[model samples]
Target chain A: MSAKKTEYGEDQDLLMKKSDRRTFLKGCSVAAAAASAALTSGCIPSVAAENSEEMKLRWQEFFKKNYRLMTQEEKDATVARLERLAKLRDGLDVQMGSYPPLKGVLYGYGFNITRCEGFMECVAACVKENNLDRKTNTQYIRIFEMEPGKLDPGTGDGQYYHKVPVENKFYMGTQCFHCENAPCTKACPTKATWREPDGIVVVDYDWCIGCRYCQAACPYYGRRFNWGKPEIPRQEINLRQHYLGNRVRPKGKMEKCTFCIQRTRKGRLPACVEACPTGARVFGNLLDPDSEIRYVLKHKKVFRMKEELGTDPKFWYFID
Target chain B: MQLFLTGLILLVGITTLFWGRARASESSFLDEVKKSTARFDNRSVPLVKEVTEDTVLSHEKYQGGSFRVLARKKNIERYQCSNCHNDKPVTVNRGAELTHGDIVLNHGSAERGLVCIDCHSPEQRDYLEDKKGRKIDFDHSYDLCGQCHFRQKRDWIGGAHGKRVVNWAGDRVVYNCTTCHDPHSPRFEKRFPATYSVPLD
Candidate 1:
């Protein structure tokens, strides 16, 4: 063979180098061949439920079953049960985020219109964990699942989520839509409320200068500027914290979802993301072309909470 | 015999030339990708002397409005470690993972630096860039964070922590390090007191 042809032959041999290690880089031809063989031999994971009626019935029963309020013990048991369901659904194992010794911890709420049983453990979770001034312990996200039957209801037909867990309901959770162009960041006089590169909007307690620019700028009312140092017992203090994202946030500073940066920023997922059982919430980098969040936007017919206003939120919505 | 020896030396020299590129190809390939992404050949990842050199993350703690004190206290250019380690984990070669999640000392597991961006982002949690300045790249932390923690983001969904609705199924999608953690303080996870010792919680 000519010198160039010989080099090409060597390259082909290198490409064909196969020991048991081929699984790592099977290459397009090999992977396609394997896939084709598997499909021909009926080895592919099935797309349709083997028994659609059974699946539908089970789904119906799941919808009908009452997800009522639970005590600490009950919630713990419930968490275990949900963990089991998650493994069965996706074959992935996960543990939920828990609070300090108190039966309850950090307070925040979210409503999934499709899956929400509506007892609002989330609402209650926020109240107890956040020690919300009972009048306003309502800091968590609340999404109402709604439907317009008049439109085509398969997927892209819904406008907003309202009162989730209703039949044929899909839920959405929105909180502190921490925009890259956060109006809150703009309105801050003392430059207190600012966007973390990680994408969370935060308020520096000592540095805030108590300006409510963040609260006013937030359209979702997601930003909560602390009017006073929240009065919780020192004993109730959850001291394990990060400076900006966690720690006992002092009063007169604003606070919203840090995307659970204290936890989620770490390897762990956010409290609300972990708390969810139905597999609804999705988070990832907007910049990364291959990230899961990118894939969601790429494949699914997703809609930003508000597209016309031009806030360009990273948060998204869709129907299942 | 002399001619044979000369031939042998040429063969060995050529073999070693190819061998260096072969052995070092994976890292160089990743480095090439990183540079292409940033449109930068790195210039060089600077190394500064601060908390010894074993740890990869520089604890340039942010305060007030700017990275003034942090910049003044630490001589990053003098010891910019990234000069050598372009893309791979430092612990594997240059610096070690902060098994304790801390740069200087051991506090616990979750708090240490398992990844690079645990402490180096474009904008820090405090929203302050490095003292030298903030104009060098795409969200500083965004690119660096994912360079290490490829698995943690598999779970965050919506405004919550784990995926609930959007896209939690199909193939799992993990995002970058900055998507979650601040690089200044590399926390692996909340101190999973239960996972390790009994809970003080």
Candidate 2:
């Protein structure tokens, strides 16, 4: 057969190789289909809810393959099912993006150490944009307030209540750095977490086994596990989502910052950077020599949180 | 040995010229980037709200290196100073109740304080006056700011000191100085964070 192209520019020959594995996975799928058919046709006794649209969508979601191995058709089908499921369950018409990484773009972030005033604006923006669990107050970004005379963050306080920018204190913000040599991605037993071509570290929620191995491996405390089902207010749910990024995740899965993949993939600034009133946060294509991140690297005296660990974090901190 | 030395000199001269030419095309480089990233107009993706009241740096002073800045006039509460300060002779009334009482005029150091007329033109209230007595438009207030804060101006020009709006790519539009900092009171005020972190035990 003539070779056809896929989103990643992979040919049909490569897809055939992936389908070979799909055949092996079909054993589990066949069983699920059998059970689903019995439940739908009343051959097997089940509650009324079992035959509902949400239940059917869950069955389809259960048998889905890893996001990486899915073909273009499969990806589209998965996104469609999720969209339909959101409508069925929450009565919310949500759009889920399965966009591939943009060509010739490597995202990087710049945080101005001097400019940050311990304002948790980035954290608030992240929580809303990512639709984070409000029950546990899950926040991906942390702004640490540090004392003067030392640059050490170990003694810094991530939790400070009172008026901010207290006399001699400085603020430093931290999140998933999307490191080049990420230990968290390496420690994922199921390969559920991996870095995209554009340098965003993404977690496939369905594929993740809730191992928590990645959490232990991360030196930056970047990964967060959902101990219980995420409870988001119906009104506050961000309708825009990305499959690998901020799509509503089930309990027992791992999630972290994907640099707002839903927004950045569309060439928009990450929500944190957008919400920053001080102009302290900078986000841009690292490969573009003329990008603001590049200019910051060239002109400012910048440093990462921990260089000894050799994570090669794309996130940087700079002071005037 | 003589041929090698001549070749070395020629190579150095050629390299210098190429470097100079590349340095001169900084603005053109941004134009090219904007054109190449034009394919980002994906219909499936909703377009980000575009800013319209934006102005570019002048080619005469900025050497053709233009970047987008939000227009200040639109945000200004009381614009067209000419509306009130119309072509009338200036009246110095320290005794009369102040027209602009809200203005604190706390810019500059305690000893070297700035009055309204220092930056604002008494002769032409609508326009700002630079150190050289040049009339500067409110839209291009960066020029007026660059007169004193040249370092910050240089950084802003290089995309370091300011915030970019809308998209990180294509047609770079940045917030001008007055957008973030009040020209009269430039320092940012300390305020409470949006949310608090988990309290430490």
Candidate topping lDDT: 2
TM-score of chain A of each: 0.54, 0.90
Provide the TM-score for each candidate, comma-separated: 0.38, 0.83
Error of 2 at A286 (Å): 0.9
True contacts kept of each: 0.03, 0.54
Question: Candidate 2, residues A1-320: lDDT per residue as tens digits?
Answer: 01111323452345457767777777777787777776666754455445566776777788787787787899999999999988887788999989888876778899998889877888999999998888888888888889876566667898887888888889888889988767997798877888777878899999899999999999988889888767888889899988988888988999999999988988788999989988889998876767788778879999887876667788989988
For B44-67, candidate 2 gives per-residue lDDT tens digits of: 334455556656643222211355
Count clashes in each candidate, considering only residues at least 3 apart in sequence or on different chains: 62, 0
Best candidate according to TM-score: 2
Off by over 4 Å in 2: A1-22, A39-52, B1-49, B52-65, B87-98, B199-201
Model 2 DockQ (Cα-based): 0.26
- TM-score, model 2 to reference: 0.83
Choose the strongest candidate by DockQ.
2
